[model samples]
Target: MSNNGGNGGGSVLATFEAGTQGWSGTSLAGGPWSTTAWSSQGSRSLQGDITMSAGSQHYLLKSGSTNFTGYTKLRATVKGASWGSYGSGLGVKLFVKHGSSYAWKDSGWVTISAGGLANLTLDLAGVNLADIKEYGIQFIGASNASGTTAVYVDNVVLGN
Candidate 1:
């Protein structure tokens, strides 16, 4: 349970155990997103077809008002299939929204090897945690052949 009754710190934001778990996907490249059997925890994971193109933002988001006032970290398990590369410029981020404003925190460019699972942690500094009306994942830019990459995310949690 979260401090604000599942809307804040000490909460599992998503596990993808029950369908999409309120998360939806969108991408500039028009790739599809869904829940897949490949997961690091539970029975499913959120899968997004992210394009390895500059300026393309592919994400899976859940809209809600959450009070994450005391949380300083966001964690998740991720894996990628057919990933082209895992070097500089290839990264991911977590974003939180308050009203019309949004704050983003990078995952320090954590590497997700081809078909390998990895734990990702991002700092929640400078975010308006008190009124987080939306939260999501962002697949950052990657300079590779123009193609789509399959990425899976699971066990998203918020904590100290």
Candidate 2:
């Protein structure tokens, strides 16, 4: 992990410039994650195919000793193929692992239009970030629906 001292926040966690950077997705409807040229920060971004479903959780994880002790937020640049039904279920979250179980945090529903890159931020004010064995990005919501959709993620950072 490289620290960029980002926009008055903290440091760069993953930019997917080289590759998946150890990030992998689970419960994917479309998958085998790969890098794409569609990026908001660097040369490439991580891409995955996800099926939208009510009350479903799909995410990607990377293992590392990430210390978020002084960081108050997590930010990432994201792009989506289709945001089916614009319900309150469309948003992102964070999963941080300290022990065996992972502690989760939410970003609420963000207004991201299709075909454009959006900057999404999640609060880390109450998250336990010290001695983190793993960290991840979780996409939540898209309630009462089903089908595969594409999502791209890039320039992940932790800051205040």
Candidate 3:
């Protein structure tokens, strides 16, 4: 239940209302992003499962071009689990891909609590909206850890 204003105001991006229509994942030690549960706003939340017996490097990436032509910011509702028991929080990395060039604008880690929800915002200042080729979320951990974790997301919106 938020308003993302872009172009003139409020542009709708991937709602995941009908599955991850064009989304994909690349994981080294984790599962994929699946639309299995309806999260906030009564829509399916994108879920990511990570297991790191030695280390963790998982991804929930979206590619194949986007129409964020006039957006100024990106937002999402993010939550993490299995963190409290581990005594370490979870970090969700945000990747903003610049179109044809294939370069990326990366944000520092967004820390989320164990089973707690948080709102995240990544400023798209100086980013080429119309030329964006991909977007990604990376789940990472310190070296040689042993655990299984997860992050849940809903209402990913690009805004002004």
Which candidate number maximizes lDDT? 2
* 1-160: candidate 1 lDDT, tens digit per residue: 4333242447787777677777877773433344664877656788877666655567777887778777898777777775555434445666666645554445565544456566777777877778777777776655543466687878788877
Clashes of each: 0, 2, 3
TM-score each candidate.
0.75, 0.76, 0.78
User: Which residue segments of model 2 deviate by more than 4 Å?
Assistant: 1-6, 82-89, 99-101, 111-113
Candidate 2: tens digits of C-alpha lDDT, residues 12-112: 88888788877888877765355664777657888877777787777777776667788887787777765445344346655566644565555655644
Using alpha carbons, what is the TM-score of model 2? 0.76
Off by over 4 Å in 3: 1-8, 28-38, 53-55, 82-86, 143-145
Candidate 3 per-residue lDDT over residues 1-160, each given as its tens digit: 2353332356555556677656666663444455554375555667766664334577777887676766677776666664523335556767788867887776677655457666667788878877888886766654444566666666677766
Q: Provide the global lDDT of candidate 1 against the true structure.
A: 0.67
Q: Model 1 Cα displacement at 21 (Å)?
A: 1.5
CA displacement after TM-score superposition, residue 66 of candidate 2 (Å): 2.7
- RMSD of every prediction: 4.1, 3.1, 3.6
TM-score of 1: 0.75
